[model samples]
Target: MIKILIVDDDIGICKILQDFFEFKGYETCIASKGKEALDLAKKEKPHLVFLDIGLPDISGMEVLREIKKSDPTVKVIMITAYDEEERIKEAEKNGASDYVVKPFSLEYLNEITLRKVYKQLFEDLRTEHQELTNTYGQIVFTLARTLEEKDPYTKGHSERVSQYSLDIANELGLSENEKTIVSHAALLHNIGNMSLDDDILNKKHEFTNEEKEVVKKHCIVGYEILQILDNFQEHALIIRHHHERIDGNGYPDNKKGEEIPFLSRILTIADAYDAMTSKRPYREKISSPIEAVNELIKNKGIQFEPELVNAFINVLAKKQIIIKENIQ
Candidate 1:
């Protein structure tokens, strides 16, 4: 679980924040004084801190300096009643992740906290890399689940696609590094849909041409969002082009066979299969796993890479494949 430290002299404020953060599924520690905050921060090594600008024992700004000096990576978000520009600048200069003024909205604080958690996860990924991929993998999947929750029909799609993609990667004898990248791409493939309109995303009917065009833009949006982060730069391209087809009939960019990235070609099959077998709002009945594989073989060299289709089928033939019940 992501840990948080809350530092405020007011007992009511501390209790309220503790309740809210705990309800949000975060592990939280609270300190009423700046000196106590430093001691807790050093002992617990919390990933993030919400530091009050004024504290009973010591100045919060001074405590912030000490915390950063002790652990530069620990992110601090200043909480202040004063909104003076100078204090804000000083906080920024001292490396505060963000700030919230007194009497702020609980919703705003929730948003800020979630954003910082993801940022902290990314930082951990950079420092630990492969050793911590499993831990970070769950974090990323949780983000993907947040997207899936917006549309009921797609609840487990990301996990299924991720597993299928990983199996395909193994079939191709990919390196551990390459497989990990593929898994991340698979997990986040549809994250761009988060920016889409809910009506179109969960419509019980086919999309009109304009709505379809809007839907296609998610690839570009997801790519833009992921490419900004250094850790996901390489996987960004695969996510952007996962919908591209080999026959030059795909969207965003009309890249044909060999023109499309290889990993993306592999992802295409995995993504399509899960979507085929999973229930969607527009389609009441999902195709069975066997039927979905047949569709893949039928569409070989057109919607997917012919060689990969054959490989995926061969791999599945050797294993007993059982898809979860389709969500209604």
Candidate 2:
């Protein structure tokens, strides 16, 4: 289990954060003063720390400095008020991983904490192993499952996408290495959604233009998270462009047609098919498999590559044990 240290003079805030983190399966320790926090930092050796900018006994900045000097490996996140921009900057200079402002949402805190912790963990694993292994794949799937837990509508979504993507890869006679890339990319493509706020993710109404733009950042964020790993660079790039369209209209970079990576195009079709057939918060009803296939057919050559769409439909037919006779 992950261990966390919460240092704040505010008893209520400490209690609240302690309860929340504990409930989320993290072992937590709370300190009401800067000195106590430092002591805990030495004794507990926590994986992460949430240190407030203000403490009763000593300056939170001093405590931060002390913690970094004593154990530079521990990740510290400064907890600050909205106006302490300079202090936040200084804390960053002093080796704080990140900072969260006061009046923060628990959901947002959880998201950032998980991102940082996992990022650090992945980096550590990379240094030790120096190559991809079953452990790495399990960690990737764990991230996917963690996102699904936050949004019930997406339960099993990544697994289905992986299966579909693999099917498409095989249908197209991709090399074994290419199939492995497709599988890993499919599993982790939506891992960026973990960074999105729960409000936007669970909203029952269609997103506004601004909200859509915010959501699109997930692709870039996903890429950043995975690109740090040594051999996962291709998977990271594939995840980043999975949202791109065959036309020149896709987001982030808007690479068009053959400019977009071919594997990303395969993932695009698989992701879209599963999303269409699954229930979503904004959609009133789910699209039947046939309806979803027809939608893919309709969008082919525009949103998706025409040949990949046809191949995906065939993959679906084999699984559903039916022909595509109804899917013009």
Candidate 3:
């Protein structure tokens, strides 16, 4: 039987979704919080997810990343209260298959769930969703590349961040599951950048307070962006918390210290290293590896994790993978 996982904070909604999906001859599971949903997604491995865009603990976007990382093929359809602009843009950028707004008709949503997930559920000879996971992921990846290419400073930034995060993950002795989750997070962590204007992104002048707020919004934007993606739940923390600092000075949420997910903290290190080592549209690059490492260390316990900072320093020293402001 096809299985559907419903992640939502409203107890009433959870019960409604559960009863509805069960009536449709499908097995269903429910979790009221984002973290619980993630845990259930792993244990249940549901074929599809009816995910809400908001949650009590973490936002639905973070949960979406985690879900997608665990199983790329998991069909996810976002259920939101209304079509909020940033959230919608974020969902599309993060590769959501489709969405349904709240106060929705159960009959209509049921039809949608079946039409999209039936192929993944059945081995029908005429099924079109037989390879839905891999197929949809490629299409999203192409879109992700396109989004990044719009900004030279960030072109291939996702790829490099993924690589660096993978390297750090290996050194930290992460479990296979954790490593995969981290890798996926690195690739799509900046998907929220799609909501940002090019003019704001490439400005040579310093940002006004308003512009700075916009810049700081990318993390939350990313969190909202991936809320509808089937496979992006586990990775959402990485995207949302990567900008968070050890001292709790980061944007969107000022999550402090270990309050941030470990993967996100690790990703932050990788992201900063890459940004420092690359050229931006407005600023000259910092081209010295030793200086970059020093800068990271100098700010540790403030901007970075002390242990992760030390571990990364060792990696750079041993591999001569010095952090600089420019590459090539």
Best-first order by TM-score = 2, 3, 1
In model 2, the runs with Cα more than 4 Å from the true position are 1-140
Q: Which is the leading candidate under TM-score? A: 2
- The true-structure Cα RMSD of candidate 1 reads 16.1
Which digits, one per residue and each the tens of the lDDT, describe model 3 over residues 34-55?
Answer: 9899989999998888889988
Which window of ten consecutive residues has the lowest lDDT sum in model 3?
121-130
Candidate 2 lDDT: 0.88
Among all windows of ten consecutive residues in candidate 1, which has the lowest summed lDDT? 319-328
Ranking by lDDT: 2, 1, 3
lDDT of 3: 0.80
lDDT per residue (tens digit) for residues 1-328 in model 2: 7799999999899999999999999999999999899889999999889999888789989998999899777788888887677877899899898888878999998887669867986787676675455467578679878888888888888888999999999998999999998998988999899889999999998999999999999999999888877677899999999989998799789999999999999999999988988888988546878888898889888999999998998888988834678766
Per-model RMSD to reference = 16.1, 17.7, 19.6
Highest lDDT against the true fold, candidate: 2
What digit string (tens of lDDT, one per residue) describes model 1 on residues 61-166? 9999999999888889899997878998999899788888998888988876557657776976677765565565466567678989877899888888888888
